[model samples]
Target chain A: MTAILKMKGLGFSYGSRVVLNGLSLAVEEGEMMGLVGANGAGKTTLLRLVSGVLKPREGRVELAGVDLPGLRPRDRARLVAVVPQSPSAPQGFTALELVLMGRNPHLGLLQWEGPRDLEACRRAMELTLTWDLASRPLSSLSGGERQRVFIARALAQEGRLLLLDEPTAHLDIGYQPAILDMIEEIRKETRITVLAAMHDLTLAAQYCHRIAILHEGAIYALGKPGDVLTPENVSAAFGASVHIGEHPVYHTPVVLPLGRRGDDG
Target chain B: MGLARNRRPPREAVHPSPGARLLSLPYLSSHLAVALLALVVIVIVAGGIGSVYIPPLDMLKIVADKAPLLSLEHTWPESWDTIIWQIRFPRVILAVLVGGALAISGATYQGLFRNPIADPYLIGVASGAGLGATLLLVTELPIYSHGLSLLPIAAFAGGLLAVSIAYSIARQSGGLPLTTLILAGVAISSLASAAISLLIIRSDPDVRPVLAWLLGGFGGTQWRDVQIVLPYLVPGVVIMIAYSRILNLFQVDEDEARQLGVNVERTKLILIGAASLTTAAAVSVSGLIGFVGLIAPHAVRLIWRHDHRVLLPLSMMVGAGFLVLSDLVARTIVSPSELPVGVVTAFCGGPFFLYLLRRRGRVTL
Candidate 1:
């Protein structure tokens, strides 16, 4: 199977400080991978590079074996849809209208949203379980509801690759699991590969087929979540005494940090 | 959260009003019908009730005489003919064009800044035009010798220069930061204001003409003024409308817009250039007609939905109709002694603004 996305010898810098240097990664078809990182770990930057929102200072990024930057915006958009951390919807557009914007890449030069576009929007919303909220303004939705709406938009893009930056940043536990479940469902149903930045280690370990643990702008570990989220690696990365054991319910790796105590001489 | 807590429904269903619930997508016809009717009525009433007070019947006659298909021998009193033909019509047309220009410019600025209170003059256009007009007046450049010929060119040059400076300042690292543009505009406006004051202080005969122009009026708009404004207005309005697609993309975030196949930098440059040209053309002829710019778009958005495709074109028509009526009121309110059209617009716009604030708390700023 061809790699859907490949980054080779990539480098990025902000003035004197380098973010991603000589780092490379490839994602094959039909995989749901989680980008695990702490705050300021350059996970967002990496996703931006893949989304074509930022220019890579060195090396090449390819989508489906074709080089990036040469593809037209519409063409690239047709292949990869990105869900930003927190993107604002223009005030007063309903959830359906917002989702229909994803179909913009497939539109003809002078085309307005037609019956087919509306159908696509409805299907995406239905899949995300946001069809009931179709008429509500995006601003009126709860944080979890809004994230689903963003996901719905990505789904409506009909792209094979989806890039999500911190998709669960604002959700409570109930909603976080629901969102991850929805992403898993989407990947399975549509065969669309997902690369999502996730903050919750348990959620990442549970849902992601593979996880890349990113630290200080480079990948510290990339493999099955069982290997990557080990206790020693977790301690080294987050500087916390962590417990790594199977989840009580899901049988996935559960990371529990030790509370500060007086016995740690 | 607390406010909504107090207003919790008797039942927990999210649907508030089933009857008036918005459709999944808003359509144009129902939303625009009322505004269009009001605008039409306003234009008709305003066209008849100018300083000369041409009766509706006689006004129809004058129009009939001009119409090619209507072969009626419509005769009017000589004085009425001259006043209607030579004075009021051109003034009304100028009012329409000027008002349309300013309102559209204001709408563009509001969109560009993503702020409701943003005005066209936020970018130093007013001050730049003021400086150019003041210079012409103080130097006795013989520019304004033949009606309003030189005013547009001078004001256009000045406005373009100021915008170029603001644009340069706003661009720091290839991207145009909106906050930077606004700050630069403020600085540029202050500089132009200082220049104007200096010119006024050392003026021959106190430079009252420039001051009156700054205060704004439609006192002497004529056919010549119309001629000078048309070249800029037609092209500028066309370009603005053509770029309406880009404007829609602008409502999205900048990076997102770029990913949607818009070249953001090029679009901004085109929009800024067109808006500035329109402002210069209008300001040169009518001096500095104020609140028409700010109010027309607000009224359109308040009355209708917030789709710019409908909003932009309707705003133009509503703007034209509004200023014509305001100019008519300015002319006829005091009979032979007319108030400045700017004063009428401000008086009307102020109360409307206050009402908007009180009623629609979300839209005030």
Candidate 2:
């Protein structure tokens, strides 16, 4: 399979401190790639590098064989769309208005969103099941509803790749699996490449086609979910013990957190 | 944690047709029309009010007489025509220009900073211009101004300098936090204001001119002042309108806006430059008219919503109308003995802002 996203010797630092360094990975087209790591393990940093929010100080990032770092922001946005960990918009904007902003990159500076742009927004909103909420104020929506609306916005960008940072963050159990299911459903039809930072390792194991474990600013392990999510790897990367077992129905890894080296459990 | 996607059933045929968006179009335009109409009405009525109370209809005719297409019979005294054309009209037009410029500047700053309470006056641009005007006045600087006062050019440079300092002070790790920016602006405003006070005290034995500068009015306004303000105001407004879409994207968090392909840093710089230029031009002639900036845009947001496309123009019209009325009240409320126009705006705007702050703290910085 051709790789849709490729990173080689990527390095990013904040002042004297390093957030990601010498990181290299390739995500295949039509595949769901999950980035899993603990706090400060560089999961979000890697995603930001790909989305062009933060530039790599050292190496190259290419999306579909085109250089990402040098492209102007408007051009880069046409290639990839991102949903941040906690998505927010200013008050008084309706869901339709927020979704319409996804068309911004496609538009000229003075150009207004015409009928065709609205049609694209309509289709995107329909896929995410946020069509009915178009006229409603964004602040009036519930958490799950808001998540769907933001996903609709990302989808409306019409980018070739979708990057989601902490897709299940701030979501309840019922909504978490549903959002993943919906994303899978959307992917099945659209065939858009997805690279998501998953805070919940089990959800990552279930949803991602392949998983990578980020450790100390590099990919510590990369393979199929069942191969890469062994108990030893989780313990090493996270600095804690996890009892890894087979998920009964899906035959994926299910991780249960245990206390670290010396804890009062 | 995987489950069937059954949480939200496919919502019924609730997606409104394209007409849904098209429907809101007229609603916005009608409000815009109302604002435009209000401004026209206020300008005409305000021209008629003041020391000489000409009827609003006669004021309309006198204005129409100036237009080449129509010439009505000369009904009133020639001095009345002089008052309408030479004296009152120029002053009123200056108020309109100042008010509209200030409002647009306020709306632009608020959008860029992502705060509702943000305005050029609150963020030291006005203070900087005040200092610049004083510097020009005190030092009697020889500038090669052709038909333009040297004060506005100096004031523009000063205002730009102040905002640049505030922005740099607040910038951290390539991001400007709202709280830090506000604090930095407050500090800079204090410094510029102190300098202005010192210049006022030390430079001039007669305090009237300095008092006029501090109070901010169009008491002796001429058409030349209006002409000097135009070159700055026009291009600044065009840039603001051109960037309104990018400004909408900015309402989201910075990272998201960047991800959506907005060049955040460049847009911020251009918006700040244009807004400051506009603010300084208004301050140069009008002398720090207060709160028209804050009140006008917020009022527009109340009637319509936060879409800067409509917000910018409607705010301009509303601000122009509001200030013309305010100046009318300022000059006529005490009759012959007039209050400074800034006092009128401050008195009206101050309590209104306090009410906003108290009403569930809606007017947030």
Candidate 3:
């Protein structure tokens, strides 16, 4: 498959401290890639770099063969959409209004959202199962419902690539799988490339076509779930012992951390 | 979390038809029409019942006589004609313009900062204009000439300078932090206010007029003053209203807005410049009228939608009516002795705001 997103030797720093250091990765079109790492492994930073929210100090990111950093923000948004981790929903905005804002890239400065735009917004909300909540203020929604709304907003953008930064963070277990299922379904139908930063190893392995393990701002391993999620790689990158087995339902690799370096029962 | 579970399911199912939304086209136009009607009624009532009362019918006649197409017979006393035509008319118009400018700018500032409490004067306009007006009052310069007063110009320049310093200080490599910007503005405002105090102490004899101007009243507003402010106020308000839809996007975080194709930095600069210009123009004419900026937009949000397209124009009309009423109370509450219009606004707005907070249990925006 042709690569839809290419990052070549990306480097980013906050002041003197380095966050992402010469990291390179590529995501093929219509592929669902899971990014797994420990805390501060630069997963969010990498996504920001790819989305052009933060510029790279070294190397470059190209989305659909266009240099992401070179394009104006409006142009960049047309090719890529991001679902931020635990984004604060704006108060007083209904779910529909928030979703409609995703059409900003497609609209001119003075243009209002017309019937076609509303139809798109409605479709996105309906797909996310948030159509009934269109009139409800964001502050009133549950965390899981709000996350679905944010996913709908990204869907409404109609971009070819989607970057989700820990989309399931802060969600309860029941809602987490539902959201992931919805995203997987959308990917199957729309064929949009997805790069999701996933903290839940077993869930990521179940849903993703391939998994990339990041350690110290570099990819330590990249392969199918069963190959890349070996105990040795997991122990090395996460510095914890884990039991790896096949999931009962899907026969995919399942990861369960045993304990820290030295923990006695 | 508990509230989320206990709360009723959203009122409607997955997708209600667009027609059911209260902010639809017809409702919005009707809301605007009602607000416009309220403003006209308030203007007529306020014009008729100032310190000197002209009957409502006479007020209408005064307005009609000025119309080019309709020539009405002028049967009222000549001095009443002068009071209605020359003095009260211009003062009411100035009140409307200045009030509308401050309220609209206040709404823009609140949206840009994403804080409901943010007001037009939060960016140092009041203190800077106060310093400039005080300096002009004390210096005994040949300020009034050729139908121009240097006081307003100096005040406008000072307001712009203060905001520029605050904004530059608050800006960082990525974007402006709202907290830093507000803190910087407060620091600059304090410095300007200190300078004004020093000037007041040095010019002991002229302190009374300086103090009066700082308190903010429409005691001697003339048609000339209205003419002077219109050039800045009209265009500034129009530009602000034009950007209302974009202003709604700013309610989100800057990074989010940028990701959604908003030119965040450029939009911020343009909005800040327009809001400052409008606030400075209003301040130069009315001195430091507090609470109109804070209360007018909040009042609009309390009843109507928070969308800026609806909020901005309705706030302008509400603000105009509010100030005209406040000025009327200022001139009439004590009859021969007048209170500053600013005092009346604070007295009215503070309690109304507290009542809203108590009623809503928390701020909505």
Q: What is the C-alpha RMSD of each candidate to the true structure, in Å?
A: 4.5, 2.6, 3.1
Best to worst by DockQ, what's the order? 2, 3, 1
The numbered model that scores best in DockQ is 2
TM-score of each model, paired residue for residue: 0.91, 0.94, 0.95
Can you tell me the CAPRI class of model 2? medium
Give the whole-model CA lDDT for all candidates, comma-separated: 0.77, 0.86, 0.86
For candidate 1, give the lDDT of residue B68.
77
Question: What value of lDDT does candidate 2 attain over all alpha carbons?
Answer: 0.86
Model 1: clashing residue pairs?
none
Q: Model 1: per-residue lDDT, tens digit, B62-160?
A: 766777777766466768777777777778888888888988888887776677778778888888988887888788678755544676677777877
Error of 2 at A230 (Å): 0.7
DockQ of the candidate models in sequence: 0.31, 0.59, 0.50
CA lDDT, candidate 2, residue A179:
90
Docking class of 3: medium
Better of 1 and 3 by lDDT: 3
